[model samples]
Target chain A: MAGAGMKDRQSRMSRPKRLRKTLKIPAIFFALSLAGLIWALLVDGSSDGLAALAAGSPLMALLWALLYRRQ
Target chain B: MSANMIKRMAWVHKWTSLICTIFLLMLCLTGLPLIFHDEIDDALNPSHWVPAHPDGAMLELDRILEIALQHRPDDVPIFMSFDTDRPVVNVTTGARPDVAATAMHFASFDRTSGDLVPPPDNGAAIMDFLLQIHTDLFLGLPGMLFLGAMGLIFLAAILSGILLYAPFMRKLDFGTVRASRSPRLKWLDYHNLLGVMTAAWVLVVGGTGVINTLAIPIIDFWKHTELADLIEPHGAPPSPVALHSLDDAMAKAKAAVSDMVLQFVAFPGASFSTDHHYAIYFHGKTPLTRQMTIPALIDARDGRFAGLRPMPWYVKTLALSQPLHFGDYGGLPLKIIWAVLDLITIIVLGSGLYLWLGKGGQRMDPAMEPLWQGPE
Candidate 1:
């Protein structure tokens, strides 16, 4: 039902709307970034151990890359 | 997932990742060679350390400690490590556990003759330099903290990237690399495919790395809490405590806890010690849990067992996570795997930047300035 509704909505929207929809991806990403920052400030200060965040970048890139690729 | 929210998040992820990508790339590159450090060192300087005759008598830890202290009576022995290749004993002594203190001493003794081995000309100075460079680029604690902040940002980018993945893939199939398209699209496709596939490994390494950075605080907390109780009511400020027999302490600690191997020792006033006890640290024998240490406080006064305190489960997990993140524990093969993964990471970082920049048609318009750059 939800998928059908989304399809209907997609058909109704203009072409630009489809491209613009992809843009929402970033906003959600940034909110998460904010949450991570707040958590780090509150819980643990910067240390070698916290390097996990930086280390996660490649994987993050890979993840997003897979999502955006054309069929 | 709202339009406004996605734009903001994309901005955050792009800028954050871009800022640290160069330095991170350097880290991965340098780290690649460093992973096989032990093997490289062995290959370059062979015969520096060789085993004594199998029939030769081995020196006891007690005698070695006495000899070590003879050179620096003021300082206390912090650690005693066995030589892997040679029958020599390496002893590290320090005036105090604080990093600021300079009155430190290191010595090696022959296992057979119990004679002091001369310092190697190439001392550990080079290794120490590499370590400092790897850790903070010689910027001390501030540099470390700065990198940590950057790491936090990078992590944000990662999680945000993951969230973005679902929507991006909503219309696309997994592993759809469009190599026939523009260079940017091809690279982008490769990046996504590689990144998602290695997601688990990356997350584990990254998350653990973040946790590992808290080592200083964790040790500080442990010292403040566990060691504090053991130190108070210092019996006469621990009168140069007649250096207790290390063998005995080892035996007692082993007897107290079965299925554990002795990792190292922390003398009184050392980083892991109280004023009145020599902390004998032991770690699990298993491959997975070997890094997790359990310290037994041995009263320096009488060489009697003082107390045994196991690390909290979280702390133990932290201990285990570090080696896993660094990929140094298993062997050279594992280090090779780690390096390959690191290279994959670099490609992913570069491809992501390419995709973000190649957006719309104009690659780099001077009119539209980059919002940010890496820390100066």
Candidate 2:
């Protein structure tokens, strides 16, 4: 019974470790979204192709996140 | 951070958010429709009318003003603005030069043919209703100031929310919405996630919004302080008199800033001009610089060139903030991004309200509740 209790504690602790591993891709995508928005503002021309990338990347990231809910 | 500090911050986050949520929600919803206002207006009133003369030269500014005056003989022309894509000139006339915007009459005329352009029934009434409510709750400057105060509170709430995020997420991973948990906890997690994701945008928009609400005062200050020298040369305010040729004034203005294009002309005694000058405002040809205006003051009596005064930093900030807040500069796709973010804000506001209400029967976390609740 004591061994089982110790195992339960270890499992709880390991879940966060697992979460950290899964977080990498989504976290990078999220950072990309923020960077893209800032870049969009800094660009000189209006509605330029680069501006489109800056604006579209966040929505794409959002879609990706929604599709892969675990991340 | 200590638990006590987190508790104090949470207390602040709750009350500030609770106070401004409804107003912020209204702003977000109203603002969503406004984001596509140009597209909506175009769809409603398709521009089927063409320029009267496709090949002919545009009539002189003086001729356009004369034609506009003929339409409203009793009213004086307060402002004249040029359209970007067409040979149409928009003339704003009022009972007096200093008349308020609500009392002003606006009409468009073809500069080439000197003919009145048919006004489109563009659902302007509904749009104006929404705009007035969104701008000032129909209470003019006072309402604008009240909303500005609310914006400050909303900003405070956002800051406190961010501060609390670190503590709340200490035990959990980022974006971890526990759907299987109690509904309140689920929404709480969502609120945190969305809140953090949108923190930058909300800060920019909210901060800009607060600045926008102070527009009237800022312009007034500019007129009184920075523009005092310009107006001082004229001495006592001049009485109404026959104005000089607008075409000559525009020509002189063109000479001053040949690279830029004339955007608008504020006649004497107009809010944007001195009592004795025609403030000819010009904008750069480029996309970004077009948002920044350069005003050249022309003596209204003689159409002589007065000095061009560059706008101060604050005024420039106000101009830039207007577009950034609207997200209109980057075109349709940017508007879509703005709309999605706006919807997310609405959800955040709604879920926040839900969480607060759901806490009604449950025992309140003493740390989360305000100090006045006393050991609860």
Candidate 3:
């Protein structure tokens, strides 16, 4: 009876442990982003292609909509 | 999060991943072949041409240009690049003497003997086709923008996936994929576990690609802002300013940068150059990051070297993103690893779509009760 009760308590404790593990997702993402930023800073020349999207173009507006409309 | 917020996020995750999944799968598939393209190309049509002598004096640039121009008199050379590994030289020429023109040709030469190396028929044509399909899907700018939008959706899916992961894993371990459980549960677990492991790589490559797709606009912006003063009516006749000799212009460009090597030269009439300057593009000397360039523009009239302008932070970010996106940098081992990760991503995409569609179908079944009722 005591062992059964202990197992139940252990399972409950493990619930949030699982939740903490999920934190790795964002942690990994931010790490990659940081690495990219660092790599970008070290390079000498890059093509500046995105700055062409003016505010008036329908395509630009569409892209902005897709980017900003996060759930 | 509120119930509504959760619902909204779930919706976004479902739709975004669904829309881009197919194209992403195609890209991933085609890209796999491209990663080993050089090896594959060599394996099939082995090079037949050999140098006249290994220790012979290499041909001069002016001599090679004379020979190439002899064959095509009307065409003018736009760029020339030397290959380090092979004794080969490639010279690109165009009718209009500009990059914007489509009537351009590339001729290879045996550097030692200066003899024209005839290209093998259909060499790399299939690989080039696959690459173009992956890049623009034959749809041009609209195709690229459409893919960019998909990339943006891919980014959102990645974020929302991270959020949902927290809630789903609230009762599970980090790497526990319970294959003994129901198929749906097992796949869900696998998806979460694998997704977390590859999260960093996917985000970096995807984010950079999103920025890269914006290349057209960025170049336009650079022109509008930096080159705006030089913009003049297109019909202006050629100036009387004495054009600099190619050798002199190249030497001046070389003198501007101490350690790097010249990769190519954009002629004066090209878009990369103004009407009176040659844009000499130079790259680093190392394998770790040679694709990253440092360009110097030289005045053609006096061979005056314009100093190097470092790429802006954002633009530099885009450049570094290219290797990460293509997975061509590092080494062959890294390429293999990239291909494996790409396969894993396709699996994740497919599984996510299956889970969403399966759940939707289950909800429609009258026999099954709703998992979670919305707030009153």
B-chain TM-scores per prediction: 0.84, 0.94, 0.87
**In candidate 1, which residue ranges exceed 4 Å CA deviation?**
A1-71, B51-53, B71-75, B84-86, B100-105, B116-127, B233-236, B239-242, B356-376
C-alpha TM-score for every candidate? 0.74, 0.88, 0.79
On a 0 to 100 scale, what is the lDDT of residue B240 in model 2? 39
In candidate 1, what are the lDDT values of residues B1-376, reduced to their tens digit?
A: 5655666776777788888777667666666667776766666555555445557877677887887788778876777766655677888877764443234667888877677876663435666566566667678666666666666777777776665554443333445666666676567557656655554455556666667666666776887876678867865646553666787877777787777776777777776777677788887755555777889888877779987898887678678767766777544444554676778888878888777778757664321221121101
Ordered list by TM-score, greatest first? 2, 3, 1
Please provide, for model 2 over A1-71, each residue's C-alpha lDDT reduced to its tens digit, 9 standing for 90 to 100. 75367436544665446445434444564565556555655565553446656544545554544444322
Model 3, B1-376: lDDT tens digits are: 4456667777887778888888878877887888787677778768777787788887766677677777677777677777777778787887766543335788888877778887754556788778777777867667778778889989998888876665555444345555655667666766776665566567766887787777666655665566555445444524422456767777777888889977877766765556666778888875444767776877666677766655566556666777767766544545565666677788788787776667764533321111122221
Interface RMSD of each: 11.5, 6.6, 14.4
Between prediction 1 and prediction 2, which has the larger TM-score?
A: 2
**What DockQ would candidate 3 receive versus the native complex?**
0.09
How far residue A12's Cα lies from its native spot in candidate 3, in Å, is 3.5
In candidate 2, what are the lDDT values of residues B49-124, reduced to their tens digit? 9988889998988888888888898988899998889889999999988776678999999988989898765887
Q: Once model 2 is optimally superposed onto the true structure by TM-score, how far is the C-alpha of residue A62 displaced, in angstroms?
A: 4.3
Q: In angstroms, how far off is B231's CA in candidate 2?
A: 2.1
Instruction: Fill in the DockQ of model 1.
Output: 0.10
